[model samples]
Target chain A: MYIESQHNDRVREWARLKTRRGRQKSGLFLVEGERLVTELLASHVHLEALLYNAALDEPPDAVWNHPKSVDRRFVLSPQAFALIADTETPQGLIAVAAIPKVDPHYPSRVLVLDAVQDPGNVGTLIRSAEAFGFDEIVFGTGTVDPYSPKVVRASMGGLFRVRVIAADPARYLAAWRRRHAQGTIVATAADAAERCDRAALGEQLALVIGNEARGVSDALRALADRTVAIPMAGKAESLNAAMAGTILLYEAYRQAANGAT
Target chain B: MYIESQHNDRVREWARLKTRRGRQKSGLFLVEGERLVTELLASHVHLEALLYNAALDEPPDAVWNHPKSVDRRFVLSPQAFALIADTETPQGLIAVAAIPKVDPHYPSRVLVLDAVQDPGNVGTLIRSAEAFGFDEIVFGTGTVDPYSPKVVRASMGGLFRVRVIAADPARYLAAWRRRHAQGTIVATAADAAERCDRAALGEQLALVIGNEARGVSDALRALADRTVAIPMAGKAESLNAAMAGTILLYEAYRQAANGAT
Candidate 1:
């Protein structure tokens, strides 16, 4: 279908997906840019709609060939595309994908986000978590919506691969402790005595990352089996929350893969 | 001094420092919020001017007590303070500080950025570099200006602490190689066979982090003595540039401080 009017009901509805409330209500979120849209087509997630700007010479083969995955395809005029697009310069492609089902069962490696507020941080963590073999992501209270466009873009398609669940980390981790008796629940803190390099991260691990300003929440911190801090040589007070999380996750992966070496 | 108007000459000059060209011409940059402003005052760098929002109840103790460090101090009306601030809600304080001198001598460890465009990425890398003991940062041609407000803010005062030098990495590393013949220069690449965990990172090292979309630049990659890739366990194509750099820096620090294992 060709969409010329920005005010069309579908265009307005798609634009609403930009907001958290809208996405929660619609169970859909926007994925912009050609790379992300292409990745979406490859993933198991269901695509509700696909859009390409009319100005493009032609939609890429992924958009044109993927008829089975996408419920609807759109060739939108620039104005119509702009209405539903998040970027200043839309990549001439966008996709509306249904929010994938949250996996209730935990994976061997889980990344628990306590209240990581920055979308970029949340996205980067997700990307790193996926790259480092972290299979499950649990979003705790006050955490930014991982489905937000900024996060979806920043995840670089990693969002689709990982299993994400929204839960209160303290309560969930408490229950998680019973299921896997040997699992290590680690919280990252700046002042923790145990260096991440020295911490013995077991195979089944849940790493809890916290807010940018605040370290891991007290309740979650207390619940963690151990706290690991990345040893720093400089006097700078701390590392960025996301960078800290990514480094910790990498450390965990390295330990598990090759005994920390 | 009291400044009530946004059009005040000094206020306009301070506002101009928000842009790269303005900062370059004046050799000054703005640091926002009470925390960052406090950090600037604590650092050895000279403060050009200090502005505080009159409505902040009282200026922070660091601001009030540092009369010797500040060349000029002004209490600006809320509206005037807003003009020179980058954040939507001005933090009630901002400082104009002379750009600290870039140290010419190479340090034990260095982080070379090659066209890393995102300000947040650059800033996070700087913060992580400081935390992980990378003492020198060389901003390659095409890289974002480290003095930009966004980079400084994202750095969380790491910018104030590190030695930043602007130069082409290819040229700089070539010179560095001659000076320290035993030092190793490593470039991060997704496809590189050497795992970062296993890579033999010597005490003196330079890690080149590239642009968001591209890995290390071809010129710098060729200059690097060896290439290290953070081994991945999952399907993620690659980690965010900043996350990747931070992890590598942490790994290098881990090796130097506590042998890789």
Candidate 2:
């Protein structure tokens, strides 16, 4: 069915998914553009609605072709789509996916976030973490809503693939420590921390990423088995949070993949 | 000199630094906020002017006290400062710095950008590249202006530290080949590329970073002595351009620093 009015219940609901609070209340989030919608179709994630701008001659065939998978398909008028669109140049399609319930599983290699407020950094980290074969991503207190559209978009469908667990950091990690007593819990700092090469990174590890402005919190740092630093050879103060996190993740991946002790 | 009018010629000139054309014509760009302005002051980059809101009774002494080193200081009225401020929360200070003249030198380790176009990514790569001790950053054809404010801001002042060279990709690499005949030329790709671990990286090398959407350009690819891929064990197809560039850069730095051939 086509949605022509911005005030229509479906359009309004989709618009609400754009926000963090609305995403929490509804337990849903919007995924836009052809690539993400296609990813949405392929993934087992529950979908509420598949939307397309009817102004186009036809929506991309990859999406329309998978009509059997979509729960509901809404063809929106240009005006209605415009009202719900996040970007200035909308790709003419979007999907509403149900947020998965939290599942705290044993993590083989974990990417732990502590108050990482920037949605873009969070998404980029997710994408990198996924590429590096990380199993679980735990969002500790002070982290942004991962379901926010910018994070979802930046994740490039990696969010669906990885198991994202949001929990109170100190408590969750404290319990995690009990479960995986042998696993190394790693955090990075600039001056005081040892170079990552010198750190004893094992096969089973958890990387604790911190806030953009501040490094890891003292509370979180106390929980870490070891703290390491990516050695800087140049004059810049430090790497960006995302870059530092990704590098550490890459280092962990490298050690695991190459059988480097 | 408290400039009170927004329409003042000096105010208009400062405003013009926000644009690419104005920056190019004037051979200058803006450094905003207290941190960045402080960074600008610390760097050897020549400063044309320092402006602060006269409403403060006086500018911060760090800038104001360095009167002999600074070419000019204009204490702007709050209205004039508002007109010149790029950010909503203005720090009430800005610095206009002279863009350095292009100097051609054979870099031991080079970062060559071939159309890698997000301003943030470009800036992040600069930060990482510098942190990893790449000798020079060459913005090949299609790369965003390194001096752009967003890039400068995202670079976290690494822009000031790195020797930035903008040149045509094909011509620059070709000429570079003649000068540094012994240096290894490297580029990265997802498919049909040697795994980075397997590749023989060297101390003197040129790492070619590519467009966000596309891999390295044909010209750059042709120039590369070898193309290596960061092996991915996870489901995500590839990493973002900055992440990819950074990982490769980290690998280069790793090989160089660790004395691992």
Candidate 3:
């Protein structure tokens, strides 16, 4: 299929996916560049469309010939492709995939983002959470959209593997407490007294990381079983939200692995 | 006191500080925003000049009357300020500070950046290195300039506190080995067998974190006493360079602090 005009209905629609409102309305987000598109094809999510720039080199064989069927495939003129591209230097490969949804179920470990505002921080948290074995991610009020282009790119393909849901963290925390009485709900704060390395981050954990400025919300902090801080020997008042969360996740993973052995 | 034209020689010179070459030749970098300028005033680094947007509100008294004398203070026309301002929304405050120079002295802990090209990553590593008690930062051959605007911004004032130098890693590693025979020159790699947590990270250590695309340089890795990896429980290939370096630094700090007790 050829999309010759930038004003084509399909082209304009794909371009809208760059914004949060467009993504939410369509229940789809774009995966750009060869690496991300390849990851999208490998994932089980429904692929709505695939677009390649006719002006640029052809995509790799694996991408062009992926067995999974897409609803539509288009070879777009350079002008049309420019409207749909998010990056400065377009890689000429793009995919429209349904934002993943997972069934409601308790997980052994979860990551809770309480208004992590930076796209890079949110994306890094998702990537680190997945790497350290957090089975699910719950977005609290004010958190950046996990499907935002920058967040998705920063996730480094980890977004495809993890279960992400938007909901009130309070509701999830309450439900989690009811189900797993033995589990720990750990909230991180710069001022917290219990050192993270010494804290009892149990087998089942809900790690809550907060915004860069205000820190964990009062409501969330009150719900947490314990608040832990990463001990800093130097004079820095605190680490950025993503770095703090990643270090805590690693500590939790390390403790669990060591304990199991 | 008043600079009305962007074409002024001083304004042009300060504007050049936005680029790497300009910063290198001037041996100065701009610190923008209220918080950073305030930090710059408090730091021991020489404040060459201070510029304020005449159209914007007056700078806080702390900045306007900073005890550390500056070479010159300018009230710039909004157009003139735009020439020197880096951010989209200029805070009306910026300081030109000398790129800090530290006397050559051996430090207990060091962070070596080997070709880490990302400005944000380099800045973040500087922040984490300072927070985790890494005393000196050595820039390897291919590393990004620490004084780059993006890097200086991301460093969150840690750049002001830490001693940073540019030199070949092989020379530093060899000299460190000669002086402290037991010191561990640990390099990070994705494929290394020893987990970061389990590594015998000694008290005196030089931690080498490499580029995002490539791991540590083969030459640097050869000089390393040992290479350790951050063990991941989930399927993601590896953490980004800054995140990986921060985690390893935390581990090393944890060990030293615990051992000291």
Best by DockQ: 3
| Off by more than 4 A, model 3 | A69-71, A235-238, B69-71
B153-220 per-residue lDDT for model 3 (tens digits)? 89888888888888888897788777787788999998899888888799989899988888899999
lDDT of 2 by residue, B176-218 (tens): 7887778888888877458886687788888898888788987
lDDT rank order? 3, 1, 2
- List DockQ for all candidates: 0.59, 0.58, 0.63
Question: What would the DockQ be for model 2?
Answer: 0.58
lDDT (10s digit) by residue, model 2, range A82-105: 888898899998888899886888
**If both were scored by lDDT, which would come out higher, candidate 2 or candidate 3?**
3
**In model 2, which regions exceed 4 Å deviation?**
A4-12, A53-58, A68-71, A76-83, A88-91, A174-181, B4-13, B53-59, B68-71, B75-91, B174-181, B235-237
Expressed as tens digits, the lDDT of each residue in B111-172 for candidate 1 is: 89999999988988888888887768999999999999899898888888888999978888
Docking class of 1: medium
Top model by lDDT, which number? 3
Task: Give candidate 1 regions above 4 Å deviation.
Answer: A2-16, A51-61, A69-71, A74-93, A174-179, A259-261, B2-12, B52-61, B69-71, B75-89
Would you estimate the TM-scores of all the predictions?
Answer: 0.88, 0.90, 0.94
Residues A134-197, candidate 1: write the lDDT tens digits: 8789999999998999999888898998888998888888777888898999998888999989
Between prediction 1 and prediction 2, the one with superior DockQ is 1
